[model samples]
Target: MLQQETALQKLWSWLFENKVMLLFLLICVGGVAVSGNSASFVIENVAIRFGRNAFTVMSLLIPVLAGLGLNFSIVIGAVAAQMGLFFAVDWGFNGVMGMLIAFLIATPLAMLFGFGVGRLFNKMKGSEMIAGLILGYFADGLYQLFFLYILGGVLPVKTESLIIPGGIGIKNTIDLTGNMKYALDEVKLVDIVLIFFIIIAVISVFRIIIKLKNKEQSPLKDLIILLLAAAVYALTYVPAVESMLMTSKLSLLNVFLIIAVVGIAYAIWKIISNKLNPDPKFKAIRYITIIVAIVLLYALTYIPELEKILMNSKVSALPLALIAGLSLFNAAFLSTRIGQNMRTVGQSRVIANASGINVDRVRVLAMIISTVLASWGQLIYLQNLGTFATYGAHLQVGQFAIAALLIGGASVSKATNKQAITGVILFHTLFIVAPEAGKVLFNNAMLGEYFRVFVSYGVIALALAMHAWQRKKKPSLELPA
Candidate 1:
């Protein structure tokens, strides 16, 4: 019986590790059933949403890495972004400049907000999650006060449109139509594909360099590299592939901004950052897998059955570049000195302390980083939406972001970039189909809305419960006896 129980436990652990994939499969089935022939439309929406929400979800990674739980105070970061947008509007900054200026104004403010939140988290320690949630609400009140009264009443305001009719408070909705709407998604597909191709080549070269440094070689890696080279050659000759690549693009300014913020900046940082000393064989395997994927993507473009479904559908705001950058950052950050410290702090604060690791400082830095990322993420989201809700936009920010992370298979104790990405795709796919499904099944779309909210909050609660249960099951480790 004891052996059987131990075997069952191992099975459960394996299943939980792949929980994100399982959840995605279930969501995909429900999506197809509910949307029926409209599945493409649902897919389109998910693609667009991926650009909007993924960054915020990604922000939760650092804090979780440091075992500080989710950073509920990221809502404060969203608020900082909002404040920047407001000021940008007042300055009459339009188009690309408007969004850029907003981000510029928000960065410092977000850093300031993050610093305070980090300090507070350090003080609270074990109660960080509950405290952070409460802190968000408290900050919300101050945010309301600042926008509602302080801006128009005390601070000098130049823009009449930003104020309510009474000229005493900020308006309930600020239109961003004149500038900043779909600002980052305005490029032609040809231009976008050119960028993607460049990315593929760079990634391929980077992998080769890493392998050379490690003095590792694999037959599979050699095979995939050859295939990618073939794909690159094929792409050079294929007009149809070029045409498909131009399907979605942001404006020139948005393009420049994205390249700067999500591309060049990320590249510069990665170059400076130390990589994890992964096993040479593991590193070889990782690069080989990626190279195979590149080869497969190029191959997929030719297969008639999949070409239309995969390449020709035309997703307008996928923000593939930004996604790549964030994924890269998350993956690479894990191998740094700080990243290792985060793991140490996460596993056992006592051990970390004995190892001379400053657990509290690491946790604070994690919160600050999460806060800054969340702020920038909200900026990305609003640019796509082309408008801002003056009062309640940030209200559900923390809840939704947290829910998406948890649904992705992230728990209080563990998460990864892949899990975060998977969760956003599944949760948002479900979000897209649930209303229509609810309408079709129950004759009311509101049922779907409520259900979505319920699922979001429910996922968070379930994750917390599972974490507690796992803790109870895994007895504490004993020191060398």
Candidate 2:
């Protein structure tokens, strides 16, 4: 009884520490369950949303590192991206070249905006969040003025349809028919899958080779697992699975067999290698996980209604590649002296200053980097969307992106790429499923929209309150700036 109680206490403590993640998890599960949507449907949209919003959410990290809270001025970066994109469209530049040009144009603009925001944040140190938020609105007004009145008149826009009828301002809605649509989504699905499988097989083989050098695993068992995985993949050449996947159905059995067989093979190898504990509870839990996973495949696959909703669950290679690049950049950035200085300022400006670091410059650089990333992110997003609302596209970017970050368990003072990616998945899961769930329950999709809106603001509010409460409790440990 005492042991059980101790275990429960540990669980509760972990939940408390990760409450944001836990709450989002619950919301996602509830949304999925109530919506009665197919897993593929939810996953497809979530993956796309991850690509759309992950970079922007990540952009908030540097500003957070500098203790600037959520950089609501990231919208300024979006504004910059839009201006670049506007010109690219006007210049009749299409495909990849247009996107690259947009990025080049947005770079200087984002840096300028970011530098200004950072300087202002330094002046309003303790209230950086509010200042950033207010600055976003102020910047929006300028963006509107530029787009609505200055584009054709001041800036030479040659494209006729891009500008309004009176030839003064750009159009409210820009059709990206010939310009940079799907700029990051041009992928051949089967080729991508082959590449993925090749990478996985190579990694697995390398791991096995290393283990063999150490005499850790049964080579026979590892070989059997490899053969089994290869056989399952060979089924893809059968034309049945290919046709099925090409049509995009929720074939749970197909997915489960591929996963379960691989999992079983690995598990058996582990046991044979003496790597896994053969205890009763451990064995029972492991078998149950396998069983439940396979059972779910059959159950979900048999449901006819679910089949109707399963959409094309294909992954875009470019977005995944870009995400990997950004993650690597973050890791590399954090290993540098500038990164250490950024961290020091985030901890306490006084400490950073005492250590002979230029705190102000570090903060400005952080913001500048964030803004540049955000600008690129917006470009990626617009290309994916294919068309965009010229006047209102970037309006709520900072709010939703920050909300997603906070939902992933980030705070005002600290964040990570892990948190950003996780938050994008969970928040977008809710974003995708909640409306369908709401329509099923209340017959009103608007209710779900309102709920999502409230959630965005509510999360920001909750995070701020928590930050304040922590500050008040640790008054002695107050960050000196």
Question: Which portions of model 2 show Cα errors greater than 4 Å?
Answer: 1-10, 187-312, 466-481
Q: Report, for every candidate in turn, its global Cα lDDT versus the true structure.
A: 0.76, 0.79
Candidate 1: tens digits of C-alpha lDDT, residues 1-481: 1333466666776676655557656865775597563655765677778878898899889888888888888899999999998898898887667877998999899988888888888888789899989999999999999998999899978999788998889989888886777766665556555556666667777777777778767445754865676577568457887655555643323332344444444444443342554343333444445445555545544656444444434434445566667778887887899989999998899999999999878887887788888888898888888889988889889898887887777887788887888888888887777666676777776886786676777777776777676567556321223
Candidate closest to the true structure, highest TM-score: 1
lDDT of 2 by residue, 1-481 (tens): 1233466666765565567788789989998999999787787787677767787788888888877878888999999999999888888898878888998899999999989988988898899888888998999999999988888889778888888898898888998876788865774434445555676578678878988999967667667767776776777787876664343122333444455676677666655555454554445556557666765765674566654433245445566656766887888898899988888899999998999999889988999999999999999899988897998999989999988888888888879988898888888898888778887888887887777677777877886676566557554432334
Best by lDDT: 2
Deviation from native of the Cα of residue 207 in model 2, angstroms: 29
Assess candidate 2 and give its lDDT. Answer: 0.79
Cα-based TM-score, every candidate: 0.76, 0.73
Clashes of each: 12, 0
